[model samples]
Target: MIRFLTYPLVILFLILTAVQVPQVFTNALASWQIYTPLIGGVLGYFVLSIIPFVSRNREHMITFSHEMTHWVFSLLFFRKLYSFQVESDNTGSITHSGGRIGEMFISLSPYCVPLFTVILLLVRHMVSRDYLVGFDVALGVTLGFHIGCFINYTGLYQSDIRNVGIFRSLVFIIGFWLFFAILILLSLKSDMYVACKGIFLRYWDTLVSFWQFVKGLL
Candidate 1:
C-alpha cells in the first residue's frame, strides 16, 4: 500500500536530516559564504508561501501559471481540454474528461517541473559563486512563484484521496525536502550527463505532447 512505502521514506528522510543538520550548522559557522545557498532557498520558500494574503492580482498571476502547467501537460499527452478556468480565489482547473491519463499527467507535472527548475537554478548559482548578493532575492522570487502556484493548484493539501496522518504528513514533508536535495545533486552534473538528460527528456516529451494537444484544440 502507499502508506507502507510512505512511512519508511519518511523515516529515512528524518534520519538523513538528523545526520545533515550538524554538518549544516558547522558549515554555517565556518563561513556565511558557504551557507548562502541554503539560506536563499529557505527564504525563497517562505516568501512564496505568503503571496496569497498580499493581493488578488498576485494570486491570479500565480494561478495563471498553475493552470498553464496543466494545460501544457494536457497538450503533451494529446488530450483535449474540454474547458478550463482560473477563478478569482487563485484556483484553476483544466477539464479533460476524455483523457484520464492526460489529466493525471497535468496534475503531476507541476510537482516535478517547477520544483526541479528552482533547485537547479539555485545550485548552479551556488556553485558558480557569481551572484551571491542576489541569490536570496532570486531564490525568493522563484520559490514564491512556484509555491504560490503549487498550494493554490495542487490537490496535495486539499484532496481526501490521500488521508495522510501525522506521521505520514511528517514523512511527506521530509520526502519533499530530500527530493530537493537530490535535485541539487543532480543539477551539479553536466547537462549531458545521463541522469540530467533523462529527466529533461521525459519532461520535454510530456510538454511537447501537451503543446500539440492544445494546438489541435485551437
Candidate 2:
C-alpha cells in the first residue's frame, strides 16, 4: 500500500523534470525569445537525474526538514527505526517492520513540505528582479531538494522505483510544464518582478505560517 503511493509520487517528480525536453530545444532554437533560464532549469534537473552520484554526496538542508516529518511521526507512533540506506540511484528509505500510518506519513512528507519549499523559492525568485541570483538560487534549491531526496532517501540506486509512478508522474510533468509556461508567458508581456510580487503577496500568509512552524521546530 505504501509502495503504491510512494512509487507514484517519485515517478511524478521525475516526469515533471524530464518532460521539458522539447520546450528546452524549441526555446534554444528561437534565440530571439529565448527561455534560457527555463532551459537551464530543465537541463539542470536532467543532469541531476542522470548523474546520481553528484547528488548523493551533497548536503541538502531541505531533506533534513522532509525527513524530520518521517522521523517525528515514527517516534510519535513508537515505531522502531530499523536502518537508513542511501542508494546509488539517489533515493533513501527507512525500513521498519510495521506501522501503516507511520509509513504513509513518511512516504507523503516530501509532497507537503519539500514541494511547498520549492514553490516558495521559485516565487521569491520571480519577484526579486535580481535575475541571476534569483534564477541560480531557485534552480539550485529546487534541483538540490529533488536530487537530495533521490540520493538520500528513495533508494533509487538498487530499485527501479526512483520515479514515483505513471499517474503522479503525469501530474508532475503537467505541473512543471504549466509552471514554466506561465513564467515564460509572464516574462513576455510583463515584468516578472511585478508578477512574482503579486503571487508572493497572495501567498505571503501561508508562507509565513510555514516558516514560523519550521522556526518553532528549530
Candidate 3:
C-alpha cells in the first residue's frame, strides 16, 4: 500500500531534482576549488576505465561496495544480515531479514548511494586544508569508481531493480543519485549543512513556483 503510493512522489522528486542540475553546474563551475576536483574525478573515472588490469582488480571492490551498501541500510532498518557473498564474476548478494518497506531502501540503495564516495567525503573533514587538493583528487577517484561501476553494472534486468518494481527503482535511483551528486558538488563550496540548506531552499522555492503555476493553469 505505502510502497505503491510512493511511486508518484518519487517521480516528482526526480523531476524537481532534474530541474536543478543546471544551477548546480553553474555554481560548481564558478569556483576553481569546486571544478578542479570535478575535473579530477572525471579524469579518475577515465583512468579506471582505460586500465584493464586495474579495472578487473577493482571489480571485487565494486561488488563489495554494493553489498555493503545493502548491509548498511538493512542495519539502519534493524534487519539482520544472514549472509553476504561476492563472487568471482563481479556479482554479489546479501541475504537479510526484511520488511516490505525496508526492502525498497535496502534493495535499491546501492544504485543510488555510493558508499565509497561517502566514506571519502567523511574523510575529507579530517584532513588539513593544506592537502585538500590532493585529498579531493582521491575523493574524485572514489566517486569516479562509483560512477563507473554504476554505469557498467546497473540494468533493467538487475534483481534489485526487479524486486522493487522497475519504474519505482529507476525513479529512486536516478533521483537520489542526482540529489547526492548535487549535494556532493555543493559540499565543495561549503560544509554539508550549508549545502543541504541551499539545495532544500531551492527545492522549496521550486515547489512553491510549481504550485503557483498549477494554480494559474486553472
Clashes of each: 6, 22, 0
Q: Residue 212 of candidate 1: its Cα lDDT?
A: 100
Off by over 4 Å in 3: 48-53, 212-218
A best-first ranking of the candidates according to their TM-score comes to: 3, 1, 2
Residue pairs clashing in model 1 are 44-140, 48-144, 75-209, 75-210, 76-209, 76-210
Q: Estimate each model's TM-score.
A: 0.48, 0.33, 0.88
Give the per-residue lDDT of model 1 (tens digit) for 47-66. 65567665536767666766
Q: Give the winner by lDDT: 2 or 3.
A: 3
Q: Pick the candidate with the highest lDDT.
A: 3
- lDDT-wise, the better of 1 and 3 is 3
TM-score of structure candidate 1: 0.48
Q: How high is the lDDT of residue 94 in model 2?
A: 67
Candidate 1, run of 10 with poorest lDDT: 183-192
* Alpha-carbon RMSD to native, per candidate: 12.8, 12.7, 2.2
**lDDT of candidate 2 over 103-159, digit per residue (tens):** 544444454334533455445445646565446445544644554554454432322
The local distance difference test score of each candidate is: 0.55, 0.50, 0.83
Assess the local accuracy of residue 40 in candidate 1 as a C-alpha lDDT between 0 and 100: 71
